[model samples]
Target: MAISKLRCLGLVVMVTAQMVSAETLSPAQAPVAALDAAEPTVAAIAPQVDAEQWVRQTTSNLSSVRYINQLAALYLANGYAPLWQDSLATTALEEQLQLLALSGVSADFSRRYAQLAHLKQSNDWRQYDLLATDTLLAYMSYLEGLPEYGRGWLFGAGIDPSLPLPSSQGLNHLNSAIETGQLHAFIAALKPQDRRYTQLQRAIDALAQHSQASWPGFYQPGYIRLGTRLQQPEALITRLEQLGDLTPYQAAQLRTSNVRIYNIDLANAMKRFQERHGLKVDGVIGPQTRYWLMMPVQERIRILALNAQRLRLWPADFPSMLVVNIPAYDMSLWLDNKHVLDSKVIVGRPSRPTPLMSSTVASVVFNPYWNVPNSIMRKDILPKARYDRGYLYRNGFRVIRSWDSSEQIPIHTIDWRLVNAKAFPYRLRQQPGEKNALGRFKFNIPNNNAIYLHDTPAKSLFNKTTRAFSSGCIRVEHADDLARILLTDSGVSPQRVDELKARTNTRTVGLSNQVKVHLIYQTAWVDEDGQVNFRNDVYSYDQINPMSQKEEKFTFLFSGENPY
Candidate 1:
């Protein structure tokens, strides 16, 4: 029975090889010609006496042992036939591999895949086969697993770990189809169907095509103010055209003028460029705008690809929710998947980053009391109290013995300078009023981090372009509008919402319908107008090691486990 099965597998492999050869020379031959040149190595590795043993041994020798079982099952299902031996299947796989390399999720994988492409042209068939399998396993594992850095925080607390992933069954189906010569269909099926993902993919391809030449640097030592003549403005014009900020016609017109002035046309283009880079949309060529324009295309591509991976982490079907994008310093509310409200928001500073999490807003509080955190109490308030005896009264703050106690202790009763941070037993609570830190309303979300969305008395700070001034919690610019939406959704009448806000005393209103809230830190995404938006990596999280290290980690995970 074993010999007969081996013979059958051999026949299938030969026939599949012939089909791949015929398909390569057909109307779609142009793209496959590159793969056709590497066909000798694939053909040389075609013949195998013990296919299952070869698979097991090759997979066992590698660091991707975690996928050994899945790889074994895949080969077994195919009757131990080699999947990539056929030219058509190899070409299809190469195309998908190229897509992943370009997708900025991992720069290391991209570089490694480029090396493997070179190896495919060599005469070493055995090495080719082993590396091919390893590459496939790596790609499959990445698609299946959570993003390397975010898994801990994403699945840590408040987030639902049960949220469904892009289907593993879809991958299984693609594997089955690849064995049967449905290579193109299977490859196409594996591409993410998400709209934003596809848009970013197009953006990456466009940028790559335009990246053949080195982008010009803004070399002026000082700020290029509006209507000022600058040296060599053609470089700036070419860059704006390349970035899709200016049309080719506009670029040509600007170039033909033979002038180096920062004119209205250039200013308009600069404004468009500013909008895409999450800068203040002013026409002036300031240091920030010049800095973004000087960034290389490869770096931008990496940003785009990393964000595409982030989109993969999102649930296949997103529900109506409030989303806070930390790097963008923006908050958006979605109802039935349609954007309802967008507002400027204040996020945590780099030292105290607002954590990425998901939770449901269970209730809203009007005229909310600010229960100051211990860290802030010790770091901020205690020093101020020590310097000024009347500081507590000026800020509407009172000292309490414990969180449960309502009685306010007189500030003059205790000596602030004598109180050490570690030995301090008192809690500080700010009274409900305009002078209170938590201005008027607070959206209560269930999270262990003690983070909530609230109004701020320091409303002037929201007007700043860089709004990362908070301790940790989010401060909404349009807090009243957000509160109205949340309250109205919870079946509270508009009149009742008004009455609740007008109350001088603090009161909590339970929501009839809890709203989901997701705090994400994506630095790149395609906006609704099909424009690719990039933000400064506020926390300097853009740099991450390649996926190769992840594979090494995987090997360490099951170091002594049996490969069977």
Candidate 2:
């Protein structure tokens, strides 16, 4: 079974590599004419070296052990010739390195290779080769490390036990591209081609250009309410202009007008600023808005770069899928790569954060029963039941002896006071009704975490900006709409969906075709409009190392066993 799975994965990697290469320009088809014109003598320049010994030593010194074999294979593929030498290839490689350094996006690379700015003047061939090798290795390592860090935050320890590491064949393809003078194209292709990645990259570049100047801080003594005149609004206006919220014309107008007054123009500009930072767009300079405004340009650049690394983990395309962004408290459904539905969602609170995992929505259950998890039952229900004997009866909860047992015990028969968390053997299930926690419908996805998407009776929670109210399950505000769409796709008529909703009894409908669902925790991303959006890290996962460093340990509310 393991061998078969390995073979399947190898096939996928090979197909993906071929597709990437097909999309990218090869040596013959590439604008090598321009490259040749730029450096006429590059083709004549070659380095003298023992390729076998060079590969051996380079692989040994590199920390990325996974790519060492591929690097050796790359050297052998070129007939034991050095890929980077005193040629146009080396010049192009150096230009890319400088570009990366200047972008201020990759702190990990820039900090370690601050000397890259001076690499052009280096006369030593050995030093140049080592630097070039390190740069290539670092680039590959960066690509491989993103998925590793992403998996740690997404699956943690309980969901998926392991994530697929970078394969040797994939690395070899990248190495081959580098050896064949397609290093520029290879690195460019490695980056996510998504518009979000491009927008963030542009944003980073813009930030880097302005990093040298100190941005003016707007420190109002008190809260700047809407339509209020400030004692000094020059600093605020200047800051807005620097952040691109105010155009040159608007800035000039503000300077000419009553500068101390917080007019409608300034308020509108503040609202735009607020929207970019993921704050409530009330046009009021609240504490949160002020806090983000005070953040330095360099810090924002780092944040954008971090998010770019996260974007690299996502696939290039999803034909049809559902994406639940936990931090944004929102869900979007896409059909044929176009967003078909956008709805507010309630995710798990910080205490019981919604686990990030990829799975398929297999079935939808209407008028669903809430089989309360052990953690909720023990911590919440038991304590309340102990204090109030009528708690279970009022809440429409029934205690079953065990999961497989048909015997339902009377609530009065159990001694709630004596029942500790570990000793509790009975299963608690809430009957479907107006008060049912799983409100009207549930979308089940097979996972050990027992997490799912469902309707909720607490509809008012969706009105709040930060809706993190559940114990790992997602509460869809537009659950009925989502269910209708799913059912329609499964050959059910709209009238039938309405009829199903009218029914009082629970009904489970298996989907003929499952839809892929990705529960990602991206705190920062670029919207379709090319506007950068930021959100507060609701689960503190943002603090985890973006590199290959091990994440900090955490305990889940529920054990590994499926509680539902």
Candidate 3:
């Protein structure tokens, strides 16, 4: 079985190599081929270095060739090779892989890898390569089908019969497909005057009038919907058939319509997209979905390539836990692979963007005191406190009258308002209760941000799609459910939470056992069926592609290491 798999992978590699060599504009084959006429030949450079000496120097500092090879193998297995094909993407992979290689995969590597390893272990490179190959193949298949969904467009020139695809006019393809007789082809299928065709014509015309309109890339305000990427009607119909649940009319609307999506409708489409991507569906397009969508196709191809390069990164045996997608701005509490609760959350704003880290929820704080951050205190609260003595009290803050670092002593009682900005010596701490900023419960995950996932008094923010409202903390909507889960896990009976909520005195609730909480950023996610879904990078991070600027520094090193 293993041999067969290896042979199949070898065949795939050979076919891929041939296709890559034949189909793509090679690194060596520039569009301006004549420009390389003066460049040095391979023979001219051959005698400049000693291979044995170079290998020895490169190997001396590294303790493990096997380790380097494993990392390289793992990256290769994950299918990062597709990234190499796109001239625009190769440098990003090279730079990131170099940084990671330099830093070494942190404890995160172990946390994520342990779970994958448990599923299976490879005893040899051949086995690793086979598994990686399978992983890559699966990812490729998923990606190839990605364009069929509205997440992206796959561009090819002309109607190439050799390839099993129709040509795309690109996502920003201008000019009308106003082939004279083609109007009937699109309109005949609609209800005699289904306004869809007329609206579609109007949209097409608008698109044409604005043909010179900027292709603000993917994240722009007036971007295309996730559906219309399909240039052919039949392909759209076929994809909808596979999607299931979608009505024929709705699918038709998607195929024929030329509508620009807003945050709300985009949020809805994003949820349906999320459901297809294996995430907890809440109708809000969060970070993970955005990461998945906006991820460079090359990056995805690399991820797939690397999966087959080594032993499994995830161990089959693992603890029951919660996986919070930092990018998706969502959380999923799981026990034995079953979901306990899921909800939407407001992560840090772009300026104070949330960090991507993982930690165990060692404790749950009930009616926890909000110790304001220095930045917030100095910038927002202190100014208000100085301007209005009642501001602190109005916002439910209690000023610690006075305290020395070594001794606690009552100082002169200066009216909070009357005191000059420099005279304030007290720290501000809010009492945890109903009126508290942190609502009732906050899941504690230790980190530098002093940030935790918690409930909020301001529930109205959840209704908005763009909730960059928080200073730098995550606020949850279904916080109560999360609290109950933590309490139950911590050995506090469900009945006890009801008991605690009624109490007027402030107190804290600690979980019985530690639950791992991951504050990760994943803009891209795959559905249960392995369909990749995307989200809007509300912060516009996608616009920073290296290719966008010529002055950017870049390098491409051909190290035989894993690239993930």
Candidate 4:
């Protein structure tokens, strides 16, 4: 319960004079004697202001005190006592802040921590304390994306991500921990112990070893087929060898060849590279492949670091849950630490990108109806209905007055072209049949986005590596197999579930123990072999945090260039 204050944040925060006082530290608590310089301490500031009232009001209204970061408010409220007074906590805080850059926290964060070493020399313990806490809070905000499984890093949407945790009771628990003097312990436990974090950490360590290694310059070949002699085959060989696409033995043989050629083995390796990088895996070096080939090793480390920062929010206690990695286009079902199922999934296309969120599938609906959303109906369906006379009927679609009403309206009565899209009163419902959009299974996860995982009649989309076809909902490929597993988990026998499925009629079964669903958008991960797998940032989030090119960005810790 050390970090319990944030383990869960409650909506209701109870503050008393004692709690407020505890949050506010006085100058007596500062280790001024430990400081080499005669810096101004908290005792010098407390006599000037009504500490209790100021703190109470500041903590009470986060909006009005937006200018005063939580750290500053706490320091002022505490009579300017430094929170990082303990050398152990101080050292740990500073190191963590500096290391945040390597974790791909953000360029803005890098700039802040870069100054922490130099800030306290002239500043009051209060200013140093404020900057320290601000940096710490920013790093912890990565946990805000704990729900997205990858949302915590890369500068939060300019809002305090730490507030509004799971519940107020959890928040109170964290507060209690703080009141009990477990704040240092709380800061200690801030970094997560996720397995992915471990892998990415290893990856970065490996990349850091190669960070100074020279990579070949950018390549832009028109196109290269197998056996084609290339102008920069030597450079390409160096790039492939450096990228691990070609082994030493392979490169040695290729290097010995008098004529540098795009051979079969190299092309195959390029295909593997293309597949891993979310490019067209045609085994031909083209513009996209050449672009990735030219990417710097430091950039690779930066990408891995950013992903590591985000994935650090992945809980150590990963319970039985379903995870859909949106960018990777895959869904995984985990049960008791084992991967139960992994199925290809077609996610929302770019035009209607899948919303990242977390929810619970409390029940499974079989042979479900596809209630056309107004947005889809107006944007997608209306255009077709006016052009194709039998488009609606052929697709098992029927017009209905409202969502709740089962009574079907005469589809022929409504004029497709004359209807005003903004005021379209009719609802389009797809009947439960072979042609139904919701093929035969729908995992219901209620959310404001009005999206759910369901089966689709279009199976061909799953064949494509990039399966971003549906408007906004998820279309699971092996939905029937998933349904069987879920139904059995819900206490229904497999045989019984099969019997229900054979009936070919609409039905729903309650999932006795609701399963957790996390829709994540990770672009990099480590496989079982500890190989770093990278993917295209379909949504371009990976480009958000571009680490500065300065070498000092990675080297300020023990250099003592600026020590607190």
Instruction: State the displacement of the C-alpha of residue 189, model 4, in Å, after optimal TM-score superposition.
Output: 1.4
* Ranking of all predicted structures according to lDDT, beginning with the best and ending with the worst: 1, 2, 4, 3
Model 2, span 1-564: residue lDDT tens? 122221211211112222323224321122212121222222111113444454555345433233344444554565433445335555555544544444344444564355443433543333334456556666555456555454553222211222233457656776667656676566556656678777777888887778897677667766787667786588788788888899989999889875777878888998998888768888988788888888888777766766665666665487889999888888999876777899999888787778777788899999998877778888778888888888889889999888888578998888877877667888888999998888899999988788899998888988787788888888999998999998888888899899999998999999986889988777777787777788877876555333333432234233323332
Clashing pairs in 2: none
| Cα lDDT of model 1 by residue, 1-564, tens digit | 122222222322222343444322211111212233323332212223345455555545444233445555665565544455555556766766776576544544565467567656654333344456556655555565555434332221111222222357755665767666775566555567798888887888899997888787757767787878788688888888999999999998887887678888899989999998889898888889988888889889877876776676555355678889889999999877778999999988877767666788899999998888877887878888888888999998989988788777888889877878667888888889988888898889877677889898898998888988887788999999999998898889999999988789999999877878888878888887988899988866565533333343332111211100
lDDT of 3 by residue, 1-564 (tens): 122322222212222222333233221221221212233221101112233342233334332122333223323333312111222222322222322222122222222233223322433223233232222222222323333320111110111111122123211110121122232232222122322223322322332443353322333223234443323334323333333323567656655664333324334655665565555566543466544444443343323222211112112233667765544567778765667888878876766655444567767666777765545566667777666667766677766644334332232255545654444566566777667778887778766546677889888877665565666567888988888877787789778888886776666766657777765444443434534444445444333222211122111111111100
Enumerate clash totals for all models, in the order shown. Answer: 2, 0, 58, 10
Which scores higher on lDDT, 1 or 2?
Answer: 1
What is the Cα-based lDDT of residue 556 in candidate 4? 14
Candidate 2 overall lDDT versus native: 0.67
Which should have the higher lDDT, number 2 or number 4? 2
Which wins on lDDT, candidate 3 or candidate 4? 4
Q: Which consecutive 10 residues in model 2 have the weakest lDDT in total?
A: 5-14
Candidate with maximal lDDT: 1
Residue 190 in candidate 2 has what lDDT? 62
Instruction: Evaluate model 4: give its lDDT.
Output: 0.66
Task: Report model 1's TM-score to 2 decimal places.
Answer: 0.80
The C-alpha lDDT values of all candidates are: 0.69, 0.67, 0.43, 0.66
| Cα RMSD to the true fold for all candidates | 8.8, 10.5, 19.7, 11.9
